[model samples]
Target: MKISNQNKTLDLTYPQVMGILNVTPDSFSDGGRFNHIDAALKQARAMIRDGATIIDIGGESTRPGAAQVSEEQEIARVIPIIEAIRLESDVWISIDTSKPQVMKRAVAAGADLINDVRALTVDGALDVAAQAGVPVCIMHMQGQPQDMQDNPQYCDVIDEVADFLNERIAQCIKAGIKRENIVLDPGFGFGKTMAHNFRLINQFNRFLDFKLPVLAGLSRKSMFDHLLSLKVDERLASSLTGALLCAQQGAHILRVHDVKETADMLKIMNTVASATH
Candidate 1:
């Protein structure tokens, strides 16, 4: 499978690494690290060199109870980086936002995909994404970021997530977004308990029922903290293991922080699988 925009196409026959570029000062992990244009560009270049095919840029911190930034502030934070990156490279750029104005500005600047955790539920978001003509990754979050993790309840985690994503897919199609331009994410830490997250990973392949690309974004999440009491910086091994599990289950995109390590792990896994075949 492949996802394309005006600038490039990403082949998903093999899993692809999407390097995270949080251009915010308060993201739970790696915040305040790349908010500067120079620093952000440097990280983007390094991720690309390290084998990332996509650079996901987020201006706002969506961590639980995170403070919100205005549309102007968000555009200011992300647009220059997008423009600067476009000047030097054609790597796929995904704008991680739910605001319609930000989505419009990011795409106009050079973003190739809209990776909204809100699934385009924000007013005007659906229309902006449909009009942008880029691939859209809709994630399932039980509630708004501020309180999503407060008391997330699900009768059945997998089924509920699947149902939510299915409904979003229908809404996107109804909004004129083509079926092929959609991707699905189970949303690892968005509002899930540790058990809910583990269950999703174990049954990750269930999302393939739609036959669309699935994106796994469990890199350095709090789930590791819950499972092994590991700090964010100390979760590399756990993160890589989660990534491999998702990849093995047919995830098309691995959204992560450790680009080089994840890329190397996937290379090794692919090499071994090919040898057996």
Candidate 2:
């Protein structure tokens, strides 16, 4: 599959890495890491050198219980970084926001994709993405980030998530977003228990039936901590494990924090997978 964006189509011939760049002081996972333009530009180049095909920039912290940022604040934080990355490099850029206004401004500043955690349903979000003309990654979350994990439950987690993604994809199509510009995410760690996340990871390839590339954003997620009994700062090993597992499960894209490690793992796995075939 290929993601159509800005007169270019990103061919999904192998597992692609999307380095995470959060311009926030409260990203829950990597807060205060790259809030400045100089630091962010350096990190973005390093990821690209280390083999990241995409740079996903976000200003808001969608981590569980994160307070929302105003539209102006969100745009203020992310757009400049997006523009800086574009000015420095041409790596595919994904704006990780759900707000319609932010989406509009980010795209205008040169974002190649819209990674909407809300699946582009926030007030004017769908319309903004439709007008932006970029690849849209629709993700499934049980509720808003502020309370998503408060009591996330599912009688059948995988089926329900697939259903939600399917419906969201249909909605985007109905809203005039091209099918080739669509991707689906199971939303690991968004609003799921460890069991739910494990099941989704184990069965992620089932989503291929939707005919869109699958992206797995499980880096440093709580599931790794719950399974490995590690602190957030100590979960690198588990995060790499999940990234590798997701790639083996046929994930077309991996949204990750540790890009070099995941990129090295993908090099070996892709070589092995190809050799065997």
Candidate 3:
């Protein structure tokens, strides 16, 4: 499968690595690390050189209990970096945001995709995304980020997530967004308990029923921290394992922090699978 905008295209026939570039000062893992223009560009180029097909740029910290930033602040934080990246590279860029204005402005600046954790439920978000004319990734979150992790309950985690994504897909289509331009994420750590997270990963194939590309954003999530008693920096091994498992389950995109390691793992897996086939 291929996701394209006028400026760039990502071929997902093989697994694709989407490097995470959080331009915020409070993101869970890499906050304050690339909040500068020079650092951000350097990291973006490094990820591209390390085999990343897409660079996901986020201006807000969506970590649980995270506060929100205004549209103007978000635009200020990301637009310059987006512009700088475009001047030098043509790699696909994804704007990770939930605001309609951010979606529109980021696309104008050079973003090729919208990766909204709120699934465009925020007012005006659906309209802007439909009109942006780019690929959109709608993720499922049980509640607002502030209190989502307090008490995440579901009768059946996988079925509920699938139902929510399917409903959002219908809403996007009804809003005039083409089905082919849509992608789905089960949202591994967003408002999910440890059990819920594992169930989704183990049963991730259930999401293929939608017949759209699946994106797994499991890098440095709290599940590994809680399960393995490891800190964020120590979760690379766990993160790579989750990413490889997601690829094995047919996930098309892996939104990750360790771009080089994930890409190398995918390369080896593809090589063996090809040799067998």
Candidate 4:
């Protein structure tokens, strides 16, 4: 599928890496590392140099039990970085936010996509995305970020998530956004137990029923931490493996912190896969 974004069609058949740039002090993975405008722009340029096709800029910490960031704070944290990156590079930019206000202003600052963890379910979010006319990633989170991780359950995790994405895509189309401008994410860590997350990650390919682009964000999640029994710094290998599996399962985008390695690995893997086919 070709995802329409920023007046261009994004090639979604081959998987690409979206380097994560969190301009927050408390993201679950790499927080405070890129909060400064210069630092964030440097990281974005480096990711693009390493073959990152998209740079995902996030201000709020969606980590479990984290307090919500006000719209003012969110915009303050992201707008400068978005502006700085646009001036320094031409890589696609995705504002990782759920607030309609932030989404609106970030696009004005030159963001090409909206990577909302709430999947545009927040109030006025649909209107902001529809008006901006950029691709919006709709992820399936079980509940609010504050308490999503506590006692999460689903009758059938994959099917439930897939159904939720299908409905959200249809909702976007009805709201005047084109289908080609929508991407679906299974929301790996948003509100699931390790087992549930694994179940979804292991079988995410089944979500192809929607036929829209899929973004897999399993980079450095708690599932890898739990399985590897490693500290946050030691999960790089596992993260790469998960990224590879996500690509093999039809993920068009692998959102990650380790962009250089993921890009190199995808190159080798793609070459081998093509040879076999």
Candidate 5:
């Protein structure tokens, strides 16, 4: 499968890595590391060189209990980076925001995809995404970022997430967003408990029922902290393990931090699978 925006296309027949570029100062991991335009662009270049097909850029920190950022502030944080990257490379750029204005500006600056954690529920978001004519990744979050992880509850985690994503897909179609321009992210850590996250990864393929590309963004999440008591910098092994599990389950895109390591791991896995075939 492939998702395209204008002249750019990302083939999903094999899983693709989306390097995380958090341009915020408070993201749970790697925050403030790339807030400068040059730093951000440098990271983008490195990720691309390391085999990343997409760069998921975020201006706001969506970590639980995070402070909210205004639309102007968000645009200021991300637009320049987007413009700079566009000037150099044609790598797929994904704007990681829910604000319609930010979405509009990012696309204008050359973003190829919209990766909204709110699933375009924000007013004007649906319309903006539909009009942008780019691939949209609608993620399932149980609540707003400020309080999503306070105490997330689900009768059945897998079913509830699937139901939410299904509804969002229908909404996107109703809003005039074409089916081929949509991607689904089950949202591994948005509001999930440790068990909920593990269960979601194990049953990740359940989302295939919708027949849309599935994006798994479990890189260096707190779930690893809970599962193995590892610190943020120490979660590489666990993160790669989670990524491999999701890839084996047919994840089309893996939003990750360790681009080179994940790319190498996927290469080995693909090689072994090809040999077996």
Candidate 6:
């Protein structure tokens, strides 16, 4: 499978890693690390060098209890970095925002995909994504970041997520977004409990029922913290384990922080699978 826009094309026949670049001051992990333009460029280069085919740049922290950033502030935080990277690299750039204005400007600045945690539910988001003509990743989040995890309840998490994504896919199509231009994320940590995350990953293939690409983002997430009592920085081992597990379960893209490590794991898994075949 592949995700493509006018300026970029990402091959997903084999699992790919999307390096996370948060240009926010308070993301749960790696916040305030690359808020500067040069710093963001440097990190982008490192991830590309580390085998990241996609660089997902987020201007707002969507961590639970995270404050919302205005569209102007978000565009200011991310556009310059997008332009700078495009001047030097053609790597797939994913604008990670739900605001329509931010989405419009980021794509104009050279973003190739829209990765919205809200699944385009924000007013004007669907129209902007449909008009931008880039691949859109619709993630499932039950509530706003401020209260999503306060008490996320689901009679059946996988089924509920699948139902939500399916509905979003239908909406996108109705809005004129091409089927090939849509991707699905189950929103591993957005509104899920630790057990909910595990079940989602295990039954991940069910999401492919839409026949769209599925993105799994479990890198250094709170799920590991809750399950293993490990802090964010100390979750690399657990994170890589989750990546490998997701890939084995047919995840098309793995949004991650440890790019090189996850890339290495995918290499080994691919090699062994090829040998077996």
Clashes per prediction?
Answer: 0, 0, 0, 0, 0, 0
Models 1 onward score TM values of 0.99, 0.98, 0.98, 0.97, 0.99, 0.98
Candidate 2: where are CA atoms >4 Å away? none
lDDT tens digits by residue: candidate 3, 60-86: 999999999999999999999999998
User: By summed lDDT, which 10 consecutive residues of candidate 6 come out lowest?
Assistant: 2-11
**Stretches > 4 Å off in candidate 1:** none
Query: Which of 2 and 3 is the better model by TM-score?
Result: 3
Per-residue lDDT of candidate 1, residues 1-277 (tens digit): 9888766788999999999999999999999999999999999999999999999999999999999999999999999999999999999999999999999999999999999999999999999999999999999998888999997899999999999999999999999998988999999989999999999999999999999999999999999999999999999999999999999999999999999999999999999989965
Best by lDDT: 1
**Model 3 regions more than 4 Å off:** none
The runs of at least 3 residues in candidate 4 whose Cα sits more than 4 Å from the true structure, single-residue gaps closed, are none
> What is the model-wide C-alpha lDDT for candidate 1?
0.96
In model 1, residue pairs whose N, Cα or C atoms come closer than 3 Å (at least 3 residues apart or on different chains), thus clashing, are none
Q: Global lDDT of each model?
A: 0.96, 0.90, 0.94, 0.90, 0.94, 0.94
Q: Per-residue lDDT for 1-277 in model 6, tens only?
A: 8888876678889998899999999999999999999999999999999999999999999999999988899999999999999999988999999999999999999999999999999999999999999999999998999999988999999989988988999999999899998999999988888999999878888987887899999999999989899999999999999889889988999999999999999999999989965
For 60-143, candidate 4 gives per-residue lDDT tens digits of 999999888899999999999999988877789999999999999999999999998998998899988999999999999998
lDDT of 5 by residue, 1-277 (tens): 8898888788999999999999999999999999999899899999999999999999999998899999999999999999999999999999999999999999999999999999999999999999999999999998888899999999999999998988999999999999988999999998999999999988989988888999999999999999789999999999999999999999999999999999999999999889965
What is candidate 5's TM-score against the reference?
0.99
Tell me the deviation in Å of residue 43 in model 3: 0.5
Residue-wise C-alpha lDDT for candidate 2, range 1-277, written one tens digit per residue: 7888766778898989999999999987889989998898899999999999999999999999999989999998998899888887889999999999999999999999999999998998988899998989999999899899987999999899999998998899999999978999999988899999999989988888888899999888888778778788787888888888788878999999999999999999978877964
Query: CA lDDT of 29 in candidate 3?
Result: 98
